[model samples]
Target: MKTSRILAAALLAVGSGLALHAANAQQAGLHRTDLLQQDIGLPGREAIQVRVDFDGGAVSIKHSHPGEEVAYVLEGSLEYQLEGRAPVTLNAGEALFIPAGVAHVARNVGSGKASELATYIVEKGSPLVVPAE
Candidate 1:
């Protein structure tokens, strides 16, 4: 009975670990890694940096930030659609600027995967990303 209980416990631990890994894998299609966040010299403002990776055909939902964003493509190709502006496709080493509060979407247009280094300068204490229509 003791041996059986030990075996069951081991199996349960492995099962939970696999469940956690699966959840993470699902989110790997669109991954964001924050690199830095710091209070800037400007009063009431902060600067943030993040690396975002998108699998082929993956897209970020329409969203807006409280401040300006500088998106620099690190790898692959991505298309950006900003509200009321023409969609722009950027390749590796390309970049774009997004105005504060402008709704936009980013889609991976490459054959495999795409990545971007996003830098933001925004108001402090406010949400970095807000969902937009």
Candidate 2:
């Protein structure tokens, strides 16, 4: 009986975590599909790649990662606002590097759909994305 109870509690905790993650993703307004995640050569670090799509006029919530990010535009134009820097716009075939822990937001500034291939090099065992204040 005790083992069953423990298993039930573990499942409940995992379920609750998933629910919170889904809620936050919906609030961000951007659709992200993770492509790959693996440990890098660097000690205690990892690399993650994701493709993010945004609807026309959609904006991503301000957030930061545990490490640096390299974003390559894959479709329509996108405007990025990074903390302490002027906003910049990029079109297909362009790319930008965002410093670690820098708060940033991306918006679909064009009239149609937009997408980006975002690659992150981050500390291992940490959350991939954290909302900025």
Candidate 3:
């Protein structure tokens, strides 16, 4: 029946829209690799290093670290945005420091892949990073 065909078409359209949205959402985050983590010999303190790779047009969700975080751009460029501050564009060899509990987002604003080395100094047994609601 025409009614049945119309219903199927509507469902298909909705399904396609959902699929596209999911794909875009997945593309909005950079790939992170845990490089190293070790105790800093201080009580309950630790250091962690991570390598993050961002494909062209990729971005990171709003997130925060348990303690201070420093990031050095390895290649390409990034747009770093922090709460209560203007966004900053960082190029290769540049670095940025993010204070504890500050929500921020990083994006690859260039036409190629961007890479960075992120180091975190945080309390042991605590998560290195956490997503902000």
Please report the candidate that would top TM-score against the real structure. Answer: 2
Kindly give the number of clashing pairs for every candidate: 0, 0, 0
Supply the TM-score for candidate 3: 0.77
lDDT of 2 by residue, 10-80 (tens): 98768755753763565555787879889999999999998998888988878899899999999999999
Which 10-residue window of candidate 2 scores lowest in summed lDDT? 19-28
TM-score of each: 0.79, 0.83, 0.77
Selected candidate, larger lDDT, 1 vs 2: 2
Residue-level lDDT tens digits of model 3 in 20-129: 35533554556777688889978888899988899899888788887899999999999999999999999999999999999999999988999999999987766555
Model 2: runs farther than 4 Å from truth?
Answer: 1-28
Candidate 1 global TM-score: 0.79
Q: Is candidate 2 or candidate 3 better by TM-score?
A: 2
Off by over 4 Å in 1: 1-28
Which clashing pairs does model 2 show? none
Output candidate 3 Cα RMSD. 12.8
Ranking by lDDT: 2, 1, 3
